[model samples]
Target: MARFFSRDRHGRRPLPSDGFDRALGIAHRWFLDRVGEVATIQYVTAPADMDWWRKDNTPPLISGGIGSSGQVALTLHRKFIELKYSDDGMLPERLYELLITEWAALTGKDVSEIDPEF
Candidate 1:
């Protein structure tokens, strides 16, 4: 079985200095600390919903909310970061960075900002 994490919000804001990189670093490490011992991160993809038909057969990977344009609307479990773009050719790093930056600025908190652990 695999795990999925997601957050949803709406708004716009200005960018912060080094916010993306720092937020991503914190989120990545935080996720590892929480679920690393139990599950391993495999793939990170945009338009993740497209793969839902095959999710049952796939390995444990992180799936965030990616628009058809590849714009990341959310991150999943901090394992994989999403971006705001639409293309299979983009690198995960670029997506991750953009995701952290936008998400933080949008919500006024880090991308890793999660709800209660229940």
Candidate 2:
């Protein structure tokens, strides 16, 4: 079972010491295995003070940004992940699909090639 940490003295939630790291590793390996070396997959947590206004109306939890190298940079918000996990409703498969879909778009790869079940 995954363990989550409570808010610290600063009243900010910190990611589980290993949960996000493990999830990111799994996601990286999944991308490498499914899509090969065409692009790099990275996970970033939203800063506590990040301005959502600049991000448009999209929920901060599942959004992607482009990198200097034209690679797809997926940012997964930790707060949202924790909320979903705590509710026992987190679906990693859904997140994977989102990432894979964005990757396909960015790399011009067929989404079916990355996830046949999509």
Candidate 3:
């Protein structure tokens, strides 16, 4: 099992992607039957500049992966923010949004509701 954390708007604390995947799996399955079980979630946060010297003799970067266990993880570095959801991949964007909105409604919160800083 992976650790989970709920993050408030300001993005102050980082929320584990693994937890998010698990939550999404349960919620989407119950609400839309769209989100499938997560097999892996990898996050690669890297700069757009320098070459990948270490990997291919390029620049500095962050890259990582997860497998099995339905995990969600994030890698944060400097330039990019990459979120890769494994478990058979996400449903269509429209369906994804509908799921999110429905979840918000169920929680008595508007889909647009988020911390101003977030």
Each prediction's RMSD over C-alphas, in Å, is: 17.3, 6.5, 15.3
Q: Whole-model Cα lDDT per candidate?
A: 0.40, 0.63, 0.40
Residue 71 lDDT in candidate 1: 47
Which pairs of residues clash in candidate 2, taking residues 3 or more apart in a chain or in different chains? none
Minimal lDDT window, size 10, model 3? 73-82
- Model 3, residue 82: displacement in angstroms? 28
True-vs-predicted CA distance for residue 51, candidate 2, Å? 3.6
What TM-score do all the candidates reach, one by one? 0.23, 0.58, 0.21
In the range 7-114, model 3's lDDT, one tens digit per residue, is 665857765555434544554444334233332223234555445445665333233343354243323232221133333234233224544443444345555552
**Model 2 regions lying over 4 Å from their true place:** 1-17, 53-58, 65-68, 85-91
Which candidate should be chosen as best, given lDDT against the real structure? 2
- 1-118 per-residue lDDT for model 2 (tens digits): 6476645757676745555565656666776778766454545565666676457754455566677877666666766665555533244554565668777776787999777977
1 against 2, candidate with superior lDDT: 2
1 or 3, greater by TM-score? 1
lDDT of 1 by residue, 41-92 (tens): 2234434465654567543224344456544444333233323323323334
lDDT of 3: 0.40
